[model samples]
Target: MTTLLRNCRPMGGTAADLLIEGEVITAIGAGLPAPEGATLLDGQGMLALPAFVEGHTHLDKSRWGMGWWVNEVGPRLIDRIDTERATRRGGFDPATQSARLAREFLARGTTRIRSFADVDTEIGTAHSDALVALREALRGTMDIQVVAFPQSGLLVRPGTLELLDQALRNGADIVGGLDPSGIDRDPKGHLDAVFGLSEKHGKPLDIHLHEPGELGAFALELTIERTLALGMQGQVVLSHAFCLGDVARAPALYAALAEAGIAVATTAPPSRAVPSVRAMRAAGGRIFAGNDGIRDTWTPYNMPDMLQRAMLVGLKNEFRRDDEIAWALATVTDWAAEGCGFAAYGLAVGARADLVLVEAETVAEAVVATPPRRLVLSHGRVVARDGVLAS
Candidate 1:
């Protein structure tokens, strides 16, 4: 199938007609004639940008369709885990839940999502199964990457590592781990097991590092050490390394992270200072952003729109200038694509036809306003439009 996206402004450039044949973009030029039988998606001079690549999300714990819950207590990280297990042990279907969120995300111009599926002894491969099922179900609409995450500490739980292995065998794409020193209390042992699984399965790795201050920095150091030792340069990602921003040695840590080739993800948490995008990029680090939970057992707030998340990231990071805001937007788009393992993502000839047509005229305005996505195309097919499924 061929689709012609006409009169679309290329970010800050003039209007162009983008022709997509099947999945890859074939040509992009102004006033190009549309071929016969080709579908015409008139953008009407809307700003066109690459669709968002969600580098972090948890579908297993998503509370989109289920009733809402406001955690009234301390609601610490551990508390959320307990709440999730207690509230989600039974009567939870990941396929249906993830499918709904996929639609919502696509409508908001997110075409690819790397989601964490908790893999512990208690839940076993149940979560992985849900995500695997959803991945298959939403193959064309949304590219789903399921990470076999041991939400529970790997060494703390005796049989958890095996469960992680099972999750990977069961179809999870990336091998995931939690805070090494903070949660497991043994950074070496935790990372050894985590890296062992990735090596054994020949899969990439991403770990959640919500550890505070020096602890978080230590965890990242250990992770970087293992990543370098294993030579898994670009294949490893550290999500929520908020500790890098909290500690005084933040600049040094950022430089180290860049040298070690370890990517970091930030959700722009409300508590502390996060990594400086400029510094990280300057030191050769990739920074991506994703909404961790969507009205899940962990937090009350949830949004599938990566654009809105980009805005949050920009605002929380104190990005006020145009270039800074543009870079902030890339945190969910181009900058994120590399971290999420997307090889062909963007609005150019030979790139994957994953683009969004927004109502704003420029990229900065689009990030600020995030007016509803006019049209979202995934694999050269219309997936969503105007914040809903495209007809």
Candidate 2:
């Protein structure tokens, strides 16, 4: 497929024409003539951005409002999550909800996502199966990585180990765990199980951490040790270490993780400075943002806008110039995209033509305004045009 995108600016930079051949971008500049029989898109005054990437999402719980509505006013968000987890059933009709959310994300210019599906003995890998189907269904349209996540607990959930192994055997890319220490006082041991499974199968691991004190920091330390000790390359991710703030000596931990090449998926907001991010980034660590949970049975925060997550991180952090904020937001898109192995997710030549054109002339304005993805392209094909939401 050959296509011409004329008069487009990327991240509010110089105007250029984007020419895409097949899946890779062939050229980017103005005055580039379109090939014969090529599709032409008028990018007049639009800014092109790499497609938004959600480093973390829980697709298995994408839709759950019926039982959720009844349990309103839960004292804490996590509390609400527990309630939803307890009472929810049959909400995720994978065939319908997965396709629905895929289109929703495509329309929003998010072509890359790393979603988690809860795994356990009783569930029998049903979530993974559904997500696998969704992955194949959206193959040419979107990049979806399904993580075999143990939402309850690895040891706590009976047969979780067997089920996790089954999930990997069935084709899960990442091994996942939640509350390493909280699941069992022996945080290191629990992590060992998850990491051991990862090492045994040569898969990357992403863990969920809710404990904010020493245990949280300790869990991260153990992960770094395990990642290096096992010689696992690009095989570890720590999600939502929100309680890292409670640890008095987190800077050194952050620095070590950076040196060890450990990546973190943070849910950053202005109020939460996330000191760990500053120290980690300074130490050359990769930081990616994840939506974590959408309006599902699992979390009160159901808004699945990666742009909003970026905006929150920007507003919460103090930066010397606008570029810092732009870079931070782009991390969720560019850096996270790379982590998900989407090499062609940028505006450069040889990259995929999956790009979003926004209304703002400046990156700061674009992020703050969180405008509709003015133009969305996938595989050099225009999946969405003119910022019109798909019905």
Candidate 3:
């Protein structure tokens, strides 16, 4: 397929014409001539950007658009975990919900996602199955990466390590682990099992850490040790790493993360303080954002909109200047892509023709105003428009 997008601003830069041949962006320039029998789409001054990439999300736990399920306020993380396990014991079909959320994200200009599927004895593989089904169902329209996530713990929860191994063997793209120090109580053993599975299957790892203060910092040190020991630099990601902000050694931690090429995913948890994006960028570490779980049993908050998430990061981080806000926007776009190691990511020529058209004059204005996704394309094919799914 050949398509021409005329007068569109690339990365909030100068307006130009973009020519996409098949799945590759062929040419980009002003006054470029269209090929024979090409489909021409008027940009109408839309700012073109790479489709949002979700680094961390839980598609299996999502209850968006369902009747309200108020989360029980908990003083501890275990409280919420127990509540969620009980609430989701009798498995609900996630196929419908996953499909709906995928449509919502696509309509909002997110074409790629890395979602963690809860794989424990309690939930079994139903959640993983649902997301895998959704992946097959939405093939070509979305790029879905599934992580075999142990929601409870690696060592604390019996049979979880084996379940994670099975999940990785059964179509999951990556391996995931929970809090090493806090929940599992044995950081060494937990990481050994997690890293063992990762090495066994040659898959990457994404660990969830909610441990606070010094404990969190210690857990991160252990994570860094395992990452460096195993030589899994770019292969390891730490999600919800709120401790780097709690300690005075954030600069050193950020420097190590940059040197090791480890990534961080922050959902902008209102209660947790996250490290400065500018500082992390200066240190050369990748930082990204995601919605996590929206309207699940664990929490009643979550939106399938990455743009809204970016705005929230800006607002919660107290960003005032346009450049600061733009930095937040990159967390959901380019930075997110880089964190997830998305190779075919960009609005440049010769890149994948996966992009979104928003009704904004500049990237900063788009970040501040967050205009609706006017048009979204995946691999040169229009998939959604005006908050509606076309394909």
Q: For model 1, how does the per-residue alpha-carbon lDDT over 176-219 read when each residue is reduced to its tens digit? A: 98988878889889989989999999999999998889888888
Candidate RMSDs in Å, in order, are 1.3, 2.3, 1.3
TM-score of each: 0.97, 0.93, 0.97
- Residue 98, candidate 3: C-alpha displacement in angstroms: 1.6
Estimate every model's Cα lDDT from 0 to 1: 0.86, 0.76, 0.86
Instruction: State the displacement of the C-alpha of residue 160, model 3, in Å, after optimal TM-score superposition.
Output: 0.9
lDDT of 1: 0.86
| lDDT tens digits by residue: candidate 2, 234-292 | 66778877656667777777777776777778777444436444556777777788777
CA lDDT for candidate 2: 0.76
Q: How do the residues 1-391 of candidate 3 rate in per-residue lDDT, one tens digit apiece?
A: 8999899999788889999999889899999998999999999878998888887888777887778876665777888788778877665667787887888888999989999998888777767777887888778778898888988777998898888877777788888988888899998898889889999999999989888788988888888888898899999999988898789988999998888878999888787688677778889888989888888977778788888889888887788898898888889988898898887788887888999999888777888788999989997999888888885
